[model samples]
Target: MGERTKKQKLILGIQHTLAMFGATVLVPALTGLNTSITLFCAGLGTLLFHWVTKKKVPVFLGSSFAFMAGIMAIIGDSRMGDPDFMEKLASVKGALIIAGLVYVLFAGLIKIFGYEKVNKLLPPIVTGPIIIVIGLRLSGTAINSAFYYNGEFSLKSVLVTVVILTVVICVSIFAKGIFNLMPILFAIIAGYLVCLPLGFCDFTAVREAHFLSFMDKDIVAQLLCIPQFKLDAILAIAPIALVTMIEHVGDITTNGAVVGKNFMVDPGVHRTILGDGLATALAGLLGGPANTTYGENTGVLAVTKVYDPSVIRIAAVFAMILGIFGKFGGFITSIPSPVTGGISIVLYGMISAVGVRILINSRLNFGNSRNLLVAAIILVLGIGCDSIPVYGAVTISGLALAAVVGIILAFILPEGDDSVLN
Candidate 1:
């Protein structure tokens, strides 16, 4: 293979960075964690994954949506009566670190049972609905963020958000060449520019911020470091790993389709799974969000048609470099809540849609009593009774509950001799 041209490398780096922009910052903003550390860990995790996979797949790792419910639960629990939310956030951070190790256990399971056997348990029927629920559940939060709560919605905010989302979606779907590939990036830039006229953003902080710094203290200093091993914390966070593992499988499949190679068979799904597990554990140890492949970056690849893996590696390096700059970290934090909430509405909805799509594509006859019962029970229990009390102390919600219920239903539902779909 010949050396990649400078333009190609630059484009690849930009693509990876752009793909991560929304996700990397959103995790820290929501969890009261360090955005810079999150970016550092995300970049480091992606690099580590590529190393384990022999740099075969052009992919970038970012914060996983699977952990959102877990983080929210932890924060809600810790902050119920606590005076300082930061102190509670610190405890949650410690739990996140411990929970990250659950990935290793799942990786081991994959190694022992192989991907095929695991798939039998978490087929698309289960995973798709889970994904869809992940998105749809979060969509409510997005819409709430985009509007006002004064018994009347803010038309200006709504218009700005819609315009921004429209620009992103339209460019992504209709634009050509490089323009088509950078819809998200372009959308963000366009939104920022619009906000400038409306005084929605104040860059004075960015201007005053130091050009270079270590650990991005402005962001990292907010969350106090309280690293301690707690068994319950570990157990509480561990269940979410199941959902993330399933997501990893989908990411590998998507990356393979983009690069035109069967990564599941090449470096092997087992290796990729193990790599993601190790990376997630490492990130959590440092008080960062669990890492997973960025679907937005995958979309970029589909648009750019540049499948070179090295380009993504370059982007990872850029993220690492940016992680050390307090100014850059602060600038990202300054992104208004409405902007994030606006985009999140789309992102979270997409997650839920993926779950629904899985069931639809499965072609399971809903007319069948068993199928209807399983789906109905799983959806209600997963979404409605999300906060089911377990053993008087533990509570499960959203994707975690959905996954557990789905697995149980899959095993309990009687397999009929007559084929309904056929």
Candidate 2:
């Protein structure tokens, strides 16, 4: 404390904001939630997270990809420009609110029983396959959006998509320093630039967009109000919180590793979980996506070596400022679909790869039929989700079904005792 100048903190604050900027906006961009509302909720959520954690941890809350499937299930391929998009999105908002409560329940359990006791329920095998399903299940939307037109795919769309995708891949694989961390933002820029010359971009919306609107007109009337709850959406979405809670613990542990301070022990894992729940519930209530602690900003802290919570608070303030200005959100909305699609290709694939890493690091033994069976059923249920839903509430087919099955199997399946097989 009292070690750095104000200017240094401000610079570090802006850097933190930039680290989270790309991914924070991507959720709304992908799912038809309001960009400004997402920003507003993210900023507010981060502040609430700090408050709940007693302002000790330096984590930044951002849009959660884990909830993307739930959001899409509720919204059902509707674009933000659609007349009824807001109506559909309201249901998803309700789902996220219920899902947030799941975190609170976990927090209570952790406080009473401790982390290891809770871990008995969700091991790597179960959580890993559930995560893989979340990513793989959403894979088709990434592909379809890459080449999508008014109602059909086209060659021009493919060309634009390939260029942006290639650019993002190169940046992610080869670019140096911070550039490597920001492939999404750069790829979107690359796609927009390519589209300008190829006539894919429509600047009419951007031009006609008001210079300064304070969340007025259609924005306030739709996304800027209180989240409306629906039972159908809550049932559809709340189940996902089960999976993401595992993710939350992983993120907290990772952040602890980076900062060399066991956040799970210090600020306490229960508090962190409660913080996330509060932040997520607040975001959902405001019609934004779920909020989770972002690993991206943790990377920024590792790179910059600035551990001040003040810096992250500064970034939260900056996010709020950007959110309050409606035009910046309008500009984000003006970005073409191909741009978001190109980024999704890399983002979605990386999510699945993370699951693979989890399984690999955990040394999951396929020799145990239990492990194999759990993984197998999860993958089949998740990937086959698309066709399965046509027969029923298909919403249950994806991550939701796989997660339930994996949990039950993990609970009853004797822990791969080789002696039993022998």
* Top TM-score model: 1
lDDT of candidate 2 over 1-422, digit per residue (tens): 34767876676676566557667888987887777778888888999899888888888999988777778778877866687787886777777888899899889989998866655766778767766665576567667777886658877778878987787668768887546545555666778888888777776645655554443566565555556688777766787677667667756655655466768777788999999998898888778899998756655554445677887899898787667775654555556766666656655665566667667767777888888898899888767864233222323345556666787888898884551232
Model 2 ranges off by over 4 Å: 1-35, 50-102, 215-269, 284-319, 386-397, 417-422
Clashing residue pairs in candidate 2 (N, C-alpha, C atoms within 3 angstroms)? 389-394
TM-score of 2: 0.70
User: In candidate 1, which residue pairs get closer than 3 Å at backbone N, Cα or C atoms, i.e. clash?
Assistant: 128-355, 129-355, 131-351, 132-351, 132-352, 132-353, 132-355, 133-352, 135-348, 135-352
TM-score per model over all chains: 0.77, 0.70
lDDT (CA) per prediction? 0.66, 0.72
Top candidate when judged by lDDT against the true structure = 2
lDDT of 2 at 292: 90
